[model samples]
Target: MLEIQFFQKIEFLQHRLVAVKKSVMVKTRKVFKNLSCLTVISYKFKGENIMKRCAIVTADLQNAAANKHAARIKAVEAFLPEHTEFLNKMRAKGIPVVHLQQIYDPNDPRKYKHTDYDKKFIEGSHEAAILDEVCQESDIIVQKHRDSGFYDNNLHDVLQAMNVEVVILTGMQSQICVQTTAADATFRGYEVLVPSDGVSATKPEDTERALDWMQKYVGTVKTQKEIYDDVLAGELIGGKHT
Candidate 1:
């Protein structure tokens, strides 16, 4: 009886010690991990102040106007002047902007019935480059081969790394790239928004339908000014800005 009690006491004491050791190790590991993230961010991004948990994701707004699709050019161009001004305002608020550009690849997410001849979006073409006016030094550029910015690209990974929760979708071809990217963002667990005034399409009806479709499956569609006010007020869809 005495021997049995001694062995049981030894086992109990061992279990207690093991649990205490694990608790200490867990706390130490959490501290180390936080320190690691701080070190990496401090070293990599020197002076740029990163506002946590939100970003502006813009789809193809490439230059080399002559090489663009005529219909897309005709429609999207009408909103460029306004879009440009909105983008500048958004970036001024310490919001990180990610520019998604499509480069030619045979396996692009969407199959185009149109020819690729004289296309500005082909790889190695300046026509595929971002327009100079909206370009900023702090912008993160993600080159993609697909219609959705998330398709075969580092966009999601980059956003996750930045700890982003809300993604504001902006850019050209309301029914195509903008719509597709927003859908992908929804599927990938982002709180998505499309400023109605920030996008354009080949026709007014197309843009309207795309906006309706996006609101149903992807996100809310609001005017840029409305979105900007909400952003400033910190009342985004998913949660308040931190």
Candidate 2:
């Protein structure tokens, strides 16, 4: 009878050890699950809060000098250095830079209707390529056939994914692609900032008119210098000036 009691006690102790091991495994899993959730939350918060919620959107910085838009190329090149410097600074701050490139689809029947100069911009052509001065391997490239970068494209989605709140417009043809994009961005509830010196047109008057229109309806119009100042002052994204 004593031997029986000893064996029974041993069995009870073994059962208790198994139960304790199961409980420890369950608690460990719960702790790890909670830690995983916390890590994701922390990463999201850092992306949306700690970093600037602003992006630089450049339109059509291509080799347009060989096309009918040669004047547009010249106009953009004049301020290209300033835009490049601003892009570098923004990149250093972890701000996103999106480049809009006009690439004509050669497979489309519409290609037959375009002028030879326009044909030079067909996909894989030299003229269709983004300018080396402003193009970066790390920058997001959005190939477009329409004037507006957001037209039937994923540009808006890209911005939304980055949690961008404000968009600074730059590049050639201020009266066309830039203006249209500004309007679209406004419609999508993004604050627009057009740098007066950063955009250009075929003529000086067109640039001025586009800037005025954008200021009245789309968003604010400021020079690159002024905008950079705002960035330095912590006013680019969610600060007082934004």
Candidate 3:
């Protein structure tokens, strides 16, 4: 009887130990599950708060040479509303806007290219300045030579400093500066968005051709309204207002 009682005691202790081990495993799994939930919540919160990395590049919107071109005037007249709204909205959203001016410096190798055109935006000419109506005080100015705004300008540096991975472009001479800049941005591994109504050239057909080329090989061509909605939704490069 003594031996039997001793065995029963051993069995009872073994069962108790098994119950304790099972309880520990259950608690461990619960802790791990809670930790996973916390991690997911943290990730979502971080994403929600992070701002988007994008910049707006407005190329060659200066009044100088633009004033001499009848086609440019007509093109701009049709889309001024879109340009105005987009510029103001970008400013309100605190997006960095780069205003590109084509200042044909006399010493530039490309100066010969502009000899046939009207004289304006000649390096330091007041006419080289962007239109007062479209410009806000917060805008950054980048004076460039030739058709591309990136030529001899601080555009790349500015974009890099802002950590911009996307460039939203608008402004004059769609077939020249705007289109060329869009292609260059794509070559540099940046996604570009060109609003169809936001960019213009001396000729409407020329502008459309440039837009088509960008859509095919350079960037995404969207309407101003679509761009505004996406920007508001935080679907573009950086974060939007919460």
lDDT (CA) per prediction: 0.68, 0.71, 0.70
Write model 1 residue lDDT over 1-242, tens digit each, in one string. 00000001112454432111111112343553443221110111333333435788888888753225787677766788887787788777667888888777655445562355424567767888888777789888898876789998799888887778779888867888989999888778876789998887767898898887776555678899987787677554222224
Pairs of residues clashing in candidate 3: 51-239, 52-238, 52-239, 53-238
Worst 10 residues of 2 by lDDT: 1-10
Q: How many steric clashes does model 3 contain?
A: 4
> Candidate 1: lDDT of 179?
92
* Model 3 TM: 0.73
lDDT (Cα, tens digit) per residue for candidate 3, span 25-77: 12243543434221111111222434356788998777775576676677777
Which prediction has the highest lDDT against the true structure? 2
Query: What does the lDDT read for residue 19 in candidate 1?
Result: 13
The prediction achieving the highest TM-score against the true structure is 3
The alpha-carbon deviation from the true structure for residue 146 of candidate 2, after best TM-score superposition, in angstroms, is: 0.6
| Candidate 3 local Cα displacement, residue 38, angstroms | 41
Worst 10 residues of 1 by lDDT: 1-10
- Name the candidate, 1 or 3, with the larger TM-score value: 3
TM-score of each: 0.69, 0.71, 0.73
